[model samples]
Target: MHLYLVRHPRPIVAANTCYGSTDLEVTAEELALAHASLLPVLPKKAVLFSSPLRRCRELSASLAETLGCQAPTYDERLAEMHFGDWEMRSWDDIPRASVNAWSNDMVAYQPGGGESVLQVAQRVRAFRDELSGLNIEHAIVICHAGIIRLLAACEHGLSIPEMALYAAQKPHKIRYGELLVVDC
Candidate 1:
């Protein structure tokens, strides 16, 4: 199966804000640019899936219209990692001790009382499992960078801890509106 993982367009937010699952907005101009860049490269008639967040949902909807497909199917597992108390807060304002603790144990640490990397990986894996069960040969998933990296880690057979470390180092990073093609 072929999977195309797409990151949402750049969000409209204050500088240095920690926003995951915070329901942030994406600007119209930026979203149109994303559509123009991605629409041509995507496979025609591919199954479309997206996180329910506004950022991702907007892209999905636009793509659906351009491709003449039905609205995308949203899966909660595709949502960004929940940052809990850190959502929409400035990163510098978050307690240093909490940040340090997360750094110490990236795989298991639940920062801002939110889901750990391991937890997010588990959900991503579940979504992958569901994807495998589908009979389709190709699909497009519009989601967050975190989940995209988690899925990439899964493809490379990396453990949760290794994925955490790898993500921290910024390897195989996906910029906003970027598409990563994976064969499973």
Candidate 2:
């Protein structure tokens, strides 16, 4: 299977804010830019999947129309890690001790009382397994940075717990609207 993992376009949110699973939308200009840039590079006949979040949904829907593929299958498992109470709060505002606790136990600790790293890895692993079962030639997944990282880890044959730790420890450097291709 060939997987095209695309991070959603830049969302309309303040810098340094914690916004996992917050359902933010992208600007019209950003969306247009993303679509135009991606259309030329993406395969014409790939299965489309996207996070249910507005940012990803908008981009995926546009791409599907342009590519003449079916509308993207909205998947909750593709959504970013739920940040719970930290949804829109600035990272600086979160307590240091709490952040420290999460760093110390990234796999188990639920930062912001949200889903743990292990929990996210489990769902992403399930999604990957299902995709493998389909045996598709190509698939395009419009999602967030965290999901992209976790999926990359999964592709590297990491165990779920190892995936959690890898994602938690690795720095996220994927830019908005970036596409990473992985063949499995």
Candidate 3:
């Protein structure tokens, strides 16, 4: 299967804010720019999936229309990691101790009392398995950077622990609205 993982356009949030699972929406211009940029490159027909978050949902809906594909199946599994108490908090404000603890145990530590890296990886793996069963030639997933990284890790056959660590420490080079293609 070919997976085209697309990170959503930037959300309307303050810089350096931790907005995992916050359900923020993108600006009209941002959404338009993303749709216009992606429309020409995307396949006209393929299964489409997207995070239920507004940031992704809006773009997915627009893309689905232009691509002549069915509306995206909004999958919770594609949502960004839940940050719990840390949602909307500025990154600089999170205590050093909590950050250190998460760094010490990236796989198991539930940062901000939310889901652990392992937890997110597990759900992503489940989604991947379910998608694989369909045996589709092409599929597009509109999601966040974290989900994209985990999906890539799954494609590489990484162990669960390895996936957690990789997700926690890997440099996130994917820009907002960028498309990453992975063949699995």
Which candidate achieves the best TM-score against the true structure? 2
TM-scores for all candidates: the values are 0.93, 0.98, 0.97
Better of 2 and 3 by TM-score: 2
Off by over 4 Å in 3: none
Per-residue lDDT of candidate 3, residues 1-184 (tens digit): 8899999999999999999999998999999999988987888888999999999999999999989999899999999999889899998999989989988998899989999989999999899989999979989999999999999998777888898788888989998899998988
Query: Candidate 2 — which pairs collide?
Result: none
Tens-digit per-residue lDDT, 67-154, candidate 2:
9899899999999999879889999999999989988898999989999989999999999999999979989999999999999999
Instruction: Sort the predicted structures by lDDT, highest score first.
Output: 2, 3, 1
Number of the top lDDT candidate: 2
Clashing pairs in 3: none
Q: Which of candidates 2 and 3 is the stronger one according to lDDT?
A: 2
Give stretches of model 1 more than 4 Å off: 158-172
Backbone clash count, each prediction separately: 0, 0, 0
C-alpha lDDT score of every prediction, in listed order: 0.88, 0.94, 0.92
Worst 10-residue stretch by lDDT in candidate 3? 155-164
